[model samples]
Target: MITRRLWLSAAAAVATTLIPGPAIAAEPLEVTAPTRVLGAIVAAEGGAAVVVRIDATLGPADLRVAGAVHSVAVSQRGLLDDPRNAPRVGAGVRKILSAVRPDLAATFEANHKAWTLTFVRKVLAWNARLAASPVRGKRIVDSFDRAALLAWAGAVVDPKGQPSPPALARAPKDAAASTLESYVAYVEALVRSLE
Candidate 1:
């Protein structure tokens, strides 16, 4: 008969291999990246003439999304005056936005604050308008995963003002996935514009 220790060791090894690693746990969804790009585009446009306000009532849990948006806008604006530097600045903005997705999702999942949903939707609608504009239309098309990002944004917000912690945690992950795609696209556009 096999020794108990040996059997247990074999089982543990199998479990280690079979169970997903942290990388897998952290393996950003494909959609997460593009969402960042979308957010960046909004920031780039909004930062051009205005600072989009996150609903002031936001608490800790809702801050991830709000904070990411704010950071993206600031970063994008920093690139404005320097045409040669815009690409690098845009890349940096994308990185910051993409990196925050998981944390944002975790916070949303934990809090599921209702007001957050309204805030996200408002932002989404505004973004959609920008995406539709002629001057910036190409930028949005080239950079964003429009439908997925919109859906993800919708999922994070709670329309009824009821708080739901589990849902909030999931929000950031989706947003991050979308952001990643958007970032890649934005970088590409920035590079093209430089040429």
Candidate 2:
């Protein structure tokens, strides 16, 4: 189990040699509303806690980012979508319904099982990309450069030296990349100084 610190250090050393700037040769990753919507939900409500389904037209979302608000078009299934699995599914649904919108239950029961397997898959994809990419950015280019560039610096200059950690934990940056299937690799690393 490579700890976050060690993993970051190893990658930082190799940052300079890695591809610079946008992978122009590589296809630009698609950043869509649905993806952002899923991220917004996760960033605010927590990922896969119950796979909360939100009304698509809720308008001006409260992502819990202290002043930043986004309106994402949630592509979600109804809470009652699976009666057989309601015990598991409803737990998540109830949490969201009580906290965000109690009315969702009626809407959910009306449209239960309208679709299936949307929320969990989206959450999984986000996790995969989150773990793979080292460069973190709000937009593809921004994070791609900052994360990778910073990693290179940490690896080459700092090495065993304690230094600032990468700006990898910002909610906006993480959410932005959450649903992207691409944006894999470009690992960057840095050490945390005990300051």
Candidate 3:
């Protein structure tokens, strides 16, 4: 029953009162405030923000899960925001990856606390690695359910390696996004909104 706009407005208000620092980077993110909500598109500067309307609004029908991956087109963003020519994916963005992600629903069923813990850890790490940069604002143009999201994240970040900023940036270009990245983006929005 929560509208996205209302949730974001509340999140931004809460983010400003807290002290900011790199120490928070290592802690697991909890869904304590509207800022911690999983999906929110925002534009922020320093510690103030405005929620954006550019990320796609996906219904169950828009999602297609096959080939062990869920992919959506860039035009979806246009439908959510500007429906002009629509941004096109570059040829270099195409990359086929194997090794499917973990079944997040199954994981949650088995142990909701563990799943939440991993999600919190990954998201906070994602914020530290990316959102902490000068760019300030990072919006989610696309999304998938929890299982699909973890699956996509596992695909982009190697099992034997950690995520690199440059590599994380490329995932979205290839019609994929990391859930942790997007959630942290919500936090960034809160910061911007508060300032």
Candidate 4:
């Protein structure tokens, strides 16, 4: 079993080589909203628990960190355009009906499934990439980069199309850092809980 500290250390080591950033030590991972949600979902024994955790943490996202979670989740379901991505029975889909937003049960279920799928895919991809690219100091890029970039993009633009000057000036940089940091934390928590 991979411990969180060891896993993060390995990841930071790899990232230091591939990513063009200062040689600063990896920041201590923060247990942000997304980290909590993913950890709860992985630790949950039943769909009801999953529904409760997701609702409590992800239901009303007021902060940029939590909102980035919503964005990452929506992207996982292909932005909810196609109905094919939604799970018909699992991922707390049925449990969410009574827990929250009964009218939008399907949407909630789709989001739940999307996040779950993304969790599984990221873990699997992490393992695969780790195994395939075992050589030290090798530069490798993957979906984690895409997710962080997308999170940055989502952070900058206001969906209402009227971003304030202050927001426009600061959101991208802050969101990019927060998104990447929170994403790594979330992934590490998931691996620790699920593995």
Candidate 5:
């Protein structure tokens, strides 16, 4: 009986190894290494400009699709003119973004609302982190910066005041895209401040 049992177990193992089952599951978008790394790069370094510049290069349809991915922010007053460094910064961000693009598409395709909120939370976390850190001129954010971030997040979720503008109102069909555009504008202004 033991011998029979051993033979059966071995046969089962062999069968399992030979038979094709299902594809391996993918990691969640928010927790994936590429997403986290991209977030860190954007938060730690002044990488939002790279995002904005990339957005500018996209055609209208592509830009709308990308809105479903993530938005970049900077503050105009805080922007510094460093044309010399733009190429280097764009290259690094492009490399990381290429890695992230597939996951972003899959996540948005799977659920657009979840994708929007995921990025909203990401920006909020960035805001909170910056707010908590000690301000060093444009290098870090403070309590004063939290309001805009909070308002942006709130507007995306509920669109009623909280610094609401008509453009960000949930328009049923185009809600996700519009929210993304609003997020991009907010981030662009914030990044300008940081730079």
Candidate 6:
């Protein structure tokens, strides 16, 4: 009999072969909120516990920012934390963002500079709260609402109609982007759990 590992490797290879190269090659494999939603769909198609790691990786901040940007509000943290909700939230955000800002899908992939300061500010503000909180077991899905999450992501991706000011003399140009990239990576990993 084939070992589980072997079966998985073979299955992955087959799957990769089945998906057209142009589809995979057309874009970088970065994970966005929409992609996470896609991952959630994949996970749902696969089975439960398929998204637990994704759920666990998300903190309240992600949900709040994603939710806010998407204009949806989920009140209960526990409900958001449920693996069942992962796909729903993910799919919902994808649909909403696609309708509202079709450009984001491409911009997020190519232009790091295009991400607005407002979006960064919102994410930073929310992260500050999470950092300050002493709660150990509390999760992102457990705390933040969909409205909050969408608001944060929207702020990051586009700061139009928001105020602007001169850059801080003391702040390095790349500091914010560097920090955000790290945070994005962390969140992306959670989204990947769905895959």
Best TM-score among the predictions, by candidate number: 4
Model 2 segments beyond 4 Å from truth? 1-93, 96-104, 109-116, 130-164, 169-195
lDDT of 2: 0.32
Q: In model 6, how large is the Cα lDDT of residue 139?
A: 27
Model 3: CA > 4 A from native? 1-108, 137-195
The reply for model 5, stretches above 4 Å from the true place, is 25-55, 63-110, 113-195
Residue-wise C-alpha lDDT for candidate 2, range 1-195, written one tens digit per residue: 999999899898788568485643322112122234243323223322223233333342223221234433222222111122323432443344334444344543333333234444443454444444333321222222233333322223233333334343321222224321211111111111100
Extract clashing residue pairs from model 4.
Answer: none
**Cα deviation of 133, candidate 6, in Å:** 29
What would the per-residue lDDT of candidate 1 be over residues 65-159, giving only the tens digit for each residue? 33342333333322321223334434444454445554444332322233233334544454454344233312222122122232222322224
**Per-residue lDDT of candidate 5, residues 140-162 (tens digit):** 12223233333322212233323
What is candidate 4's lDDT per residue for 1-195, written digit by digit as tens? 999999999999999889897655433222223333233332221222222222234432211221233222334411111112223222432343324334445654565655556555654565544343222122223222222322222222224433222312222211112222344454443223212
List candidate 6 stretches off by more than 4 Å. Answer: 1-69, 103-195
Ten contiguous residues with the weakest lDDT in model 1: 137-146
Cα RMSD (angstroms) for every candidate in the order listed: 18.5, 26.6, 23.3, 25.2, 16.1, 18.4
lDDT of 3 by residue, 1-195 (tens): 899998999898788667564643322111111121211211111001112222234331122222222342433322211101111111101111111212222322233233344545644564444434432332222232122232222323233333333322333321122233454454333223212
Give the least accurate 10-residue stretch of model 4, judged by summed lDDT: 77-86
lDDT of each: 0.35, 0.32, 0.28, 0.34, 0.34, 0.34
Q: Candidate 5 lDDT (Cα, whole model)? A: 0.34
Give the TM-scores of the predictions, in the order they appear: 0.22, 0.22, 0.21, 0.25, 0.24, 0.22
Residue lDDT tens for model 6, 101-130: 464444422222233333345445545544
